[model samples]
Target: MIVDRQGRRFRNLRISLTSACNYACTYCVPDGKRLVAAQDELSADAMIQAVAYLIEAAGIERLRITGGEPLVSPKLEALLRGVSQLGLDDISLTSNGQLLTRKLPLLLETGIRRLNISLDTLDPEAFRRIARGGDLFSVLEGLDQARAAGLKIKLNMVPLRGQNLDQVLPLLDYCLERGFELRFIELMRMGHLARAGQNFQQQFVGLPELLALIGERYEYAQADAPVDATALRYKIAGRGYFGVIANESVPFCRSCSRLRLSSTGWLHGCLSSSNRHYVGDLLDKPRHQALPALQGLLVKALGDKQELAFAGGTTIMKIIGG
Candidate 1:
């Protein structure tokens, strides 16, 4: 395993099952249409092959199934079933929750214990505005269904300054009441936001500002988090916990033990860096031929990690697993 100078190694892997998504989230894409799968997306068998190889080559222990949206991917079941049989220490999924209810049985059967659902607000109008094509009612219903199924839920909210800024308190309150941890992800400088500095500045909500808003209603204290955990967590006494994935203001780059795999077979060591290792061809080769080459690519991926802060980049979050 390649550990950076900061003493971080790849134990966690995020796989983008497909580049395709059903919702045109404003923060994800500029327009209303959903992101389409890449023309040269790898097959489900190919992706599973890569994951099997990475488990041996990179010493990956945990897997987070992501996507443009994993639920919409035709290969989701195959990927999930294949990876589950690999004996990973942990396996989770992150989605927009649009199809959670419909996919609940599949998830439960495949052993998905926890998940992160991206929801910006509780208000119907604002929800529709933020996620152009998704129905808020359906999303909420899915969340409820997942919860009832005994799946631990975390709600991921990216607070935009002028848009869902007021959603901070309400969303947190909603999560607390329903036993879900609300993770406030500070707006990342990616995709279209990377090119438009002014627009990003206008919309970006830092961690401090977010805490101030939540502090107005909840009395919380700093809480312990796993060393490589992305979110800096907090607890509000009798209520449940909430977290902040403050990539900008309180960057967790030093202890970021994550590697991302795009559906097209690129391995990204750091979200802030553009370096990617293509192993699509390797996935097709015999194990003996692939492992030696894939191990070298793992080293190059970890070599791209920054020692401290995350300097934002222009990679579309929708293209890679966000």
Candidate 2:
């Protein structure tokens, strides 16, 4: 029942299954150290309990399972196995596709019909240079396998100047041809990028420039999106849809209804804020005892949401999930 001053409430929850990532993408990890799972990550059962508790506590209607790379998390299948029966409106996953092919059967059996995969470029060298890890061939093959498996896939690409900005159009063509939605996420001033100063500004790309690049080959118009949807959606005439998560040019903080829970059990209300509420212990407590405390904490979490623009934060996106 708690809503922010801007009328935003927790309708969507993104839970990070693990903090450990297989890839050290340049944008995500400026220092090039791969993230590792926290020593105290919650067990699969406890996380499932939290999801159920939150359903009643905050009226969460959607769930996105994320990770340092969720496929790398050993608890993924078990977690999904338990979460699938909860009857949430939808359950999706976000991954780097490094292990999607291996996990496709688990995803299908668990009824995960849609997912978001991060793929910035199709070039092998660029993939290595940017992701800093993983085989692009494996990822590409995984994508094909998932597509053939009848999964509704969406591709996420962060457009950065001097990095893979040139790949935007080709990547879009790749998505459009395959019936996958391509989402161009504008680079944010987050993590080390927050302190990157001129370098951050230099490499950062915005919506106008992204549209201009895509406009060179195709025409598109603004399309409808959920009120709390982060990405601004668009649809082309003959091609499939594309979206722009223009955090810089068109901040959607006012309508942001996402609540992030790290694998080790911390509720992050806003990505741009450092504040986090610890609800791990509550997950093990009785409902009567946990519900009251968790609801109180949910209010604090909701209050932590940004009022307008995303000012950015020092916390790495992997720590809390993307």
Candidate 3:
């Protein structure tokens, strides 16, 4: 199996197919900004081939498809089918859930068994305002479709101060009632808004406090893993189970077994670090040569993995697939 320098096993791979997104979330793409042009992006075929190479070389067991909005990628179902054919043990996708209502069945048909949908607010107006142009009803419909498809669905909530924090209890209530997993992710220090004036401390909320509040009705089950995961999973006092992911105010740099493949074909060794290795350039190289080079780079980066320097820093969720 391929192992990076920090002894972090390379088992999970997150690949971003495209950087283009339909909605301009206030915290993500923001209001007015030009996104990456489509002309310079990798085609579907190239992405599949690259994934195949990585799997063959590193023995990667799980793959996650992410993007500005993975569903928006033209013929995304076809692309997922290609990845499914690779025989990876787990194949998942993280989407904004806007287009999922219409494509849920098709995605399931393509062998997508897991989904993590981003939904920050329960209010229609708040959803529209934060997500820019998203309709809360559409996202809810998509959630229903996912449940109907029997896929393991997780709700990804980004809690921003003065934004969606007040909805936490409501989200938990929804999850407990619906038997869905609720993951409250703290905003990371990478994004158009974060760079502008988003205060990390003000927006930051610790996992312990969040879990304590939920403790009123739930009992947490901590994982044995070493990674600093924010998702404090728990059973809702014989009712149901859910989780929370805290990225800020608490960092999980060590034991980070995940690697990110950007839309541009760069492999990010660590989420907090800007260091990356280009895999696209080696696409044409012989497998014998390319595999070792890729492995070597990963190993080196793993060794270099450092703890997050600050509560907030670079590395947006979109860039690496939140």
Candidate 4:
């Protein structure tokens, strides 16, 4: 096991393929900023090497490909194929769904079986306003295509207090009606909002209030969650299941077994922790030659992992994949 100083074993790895996204979401991508240029990013072969090292050295079997928008990556299919060849137990993706309709078939062919789509609002006007000119119809079409492709789908909604908070019921109803799992993510005090000079506290809505709102209409019970999962899953009476990722109100630092690899190749042991180590540099050599140094750097990062849970401060979520 790849155990940290706090004894949290690393089993999940989230990799950012690129920072270039089409939509400028208010919560995620504020001003259409790309941390690293497309040309300057790592190649598919390098990503394959990075994943191999993580799986062998860190014991991470579950992988999730994320990005400013992963579907938009020119080499996405190649990267997915490379990682899938490793025989991983689970290969999933977190995307904005702008290009998913066109890419779903290629994605499934490349071995992506699970998808977490970011759909904040059902109202087209709200979507355009929050997502900065994104088409609600395109994302909707993408969802339809994903369902038809037989992929497990999860809807991720970051409900800000004044923003999409009112659309919670509509969003949940849409997901429940379609038998798609839904997860409500609390507004994290980091990334685009911070960079935009927006206060997360002002937009924050804790899980209690969210659940209470759902409880008014249906009886709900807590359900089982994955060993290292941060979301608290629940089953509602007469309704489908849903979850809440209460990172701000109730941080899961104690059970966080996930590691983040930025598009630029930096290793982050904890999401909110600013301390990062460059693992990309080691990818230039053969896997056998790079293993020792990669293992050392991962251990160093584990030591730097946060002992206590705290709100995110410095890291950009888009750069590391939210």
The candidate that wins on lDDT is 2
Per-model TM-score, in order, reads 0.98, 0.99, 0.89, 0.94
For each candidate, the alpha-carbon lDDT, in order, equals: 0.90, 0.93, 0.73, 0.83
Q: Which 10-residue window of candidate 1 scores lowest in summed lDDT?
A: 1-10
On residues 119-223, what C-alpha lDDT tens digit does candidate 1 reach at each position? 999889998888887889999999988988899999999999878998899899899999999999998877777777788899998988988888888899999
Candidate 2 C-alpha lDDT tens digits along 152-214:
999999987898988998899999999999999999888989889899999999998988888
Higher-scoring candidate on lDDT, 3 or 4: 4
Clashes of each: 0, 0, 11, 0
lDDT of model 1, residue 270: 86
Worst 10 residues of 2 by lDDT: 1-10
In terms of lDDT, model 2 sits at 0.93
Ranking by TM-score: 2, 1, 4, 3
TM-score of candidate 2 relative to the true fold: 0.99
Off by over 4 Å in 2: none
